[model samples]
Target: MVLPGVYAPQEDTELLAGALSDEPLPPGAAVLDVGTGTGALALEAARRGGRVTAVDVSWRAVCAARLNATRAGLPLRVRRGNLFDPVRGESFDLILTNPPYVPAPDGTRPRGPARSWDAGHDGRLVLDRICREGPELLRPGGVLLVVQSALSDPDRTLGLLRTAGLKAAVIRRRRIDFGPVLRGREHWLRHRGLLSATDDKEELVVVRAELPV
Candidate 1:
């Protein structure tokens, strides 16, 4: 059950899951799900025979994920921490994340439910960190899959990962109408030149980055 303040699975989550499904997960592969929310992706990895570890910055999310895992009878290690803090020094075969990518009007850190999607002005506060730090946590030949909006600039994500020695590319794309958050910020986004005057949709892309063996 998703507790109050926890992010529910949305199109981005489904997109990432689709990418995960296509991946060849070996038996007992080590998997990490950052910003796990209700542990949907973590549970999916666990169901596929992966040893999954999920991390979230919110206690509500942590509790919700743990509860969901128990209900699904899946083995998921849920931890409460920011980004990679919970899994520091650990290596994983696969890392998945659907981080907060909506560009907020300000740079103040989000709290409560906003933490799930209210990324700072440029929307790269969390995304940039994931791109920079996520590579180091991957085991040789491992892959990192991230989902974010086109408004946030997927090209930068690819460049960052490639510079870190990973082969990065956009693996999936989906056009979705603006959700409540985006709709509310439509004017601000247009003011920032992130959206066209008549644009009412945003494209989400799944970026896959892999480390060489």
Candidate 2:
């Protein structure tokens, strides 16, 4: 299955795999992997003895993830629907996601292909939604693992999470240069119509936030 428009699953898969491989999992834990691109993270959880359900809005992504999970000798539930749509009336001990959070060209216009990558005009479209909706999905002491480029506003994202009643914090950071993606970024910022782009040294932040509210 060819998942077009969706950003390719590379770093997220690698990060998720590494995280899951580090230790033995708690018994019979349930996990929710949103925007599970290649089903790699979902598989990682399953491989670690977690009962995982992965959902993607892209049918192609869903098909590919299902196939990948099968090939890896891991059983996973793959659903094709918008974020949080496939699983309703459900809660999990963990939720993992690598959402599209590239801030758009303007504060109003999406900059690039976004079948899966465009978070919103502010680049927090999927992210904020997750924060707003995540509380309901967690199992009291549940955790949410999110990874995103620094272009996405970490402060705002964390604030939103806490406001939504969850305690959020950064778990990891990597200084990644976005010169490739933000080509002409300076020019974009110079525009009178848009807000100035924030200069961040960190390329990405991998966060693990716990829910208490």
TM-scores for all candidates: the values are 0.99, 0.83
List where candidate 2 sits over 4 angstroms from the true fold.
1-6, 16-24, 106-113, 184-186, 189-202
For model 2, the local distance difference test gives: 0.73
Clashing residue pairs, candidate 1?
none
lDDT of 1 at 136: 96
The residue-level lDDT of candidate 1 at 195 comes to: 98
Candidate 2 structure quality by residue, lDDT tens digits, 1-213: 335655575654566555555434686799899988778778878977899999987777788888888778887989888789888899998888888776666555353345465555567878888888877899888888888766677887788888877888877676644444555454553353333446533367776778774
Tell me how far the alpha carbon of residue 50 in candidate 2 is from the true structure, in angstroms, after superposition: 0.6
- Cα-based lDDT for every prediction: 0.95, 0.73
Q: To one decimal, what is the Cα RMSD in angstroms of model 2 from the true structure?
A: 3.4
Which is the leading candidate under TM-score?
A: 1
Residue 25 CA displacement from its true place in model 1, Å: 0.4
Which RMSD values do the candidates have, in order? 0.7, 3.4
- Model 1: residues with Cα > 4 Å off, grouped in runs: none
> How badly does each model clash, as a count of residue pairs?
0, 1
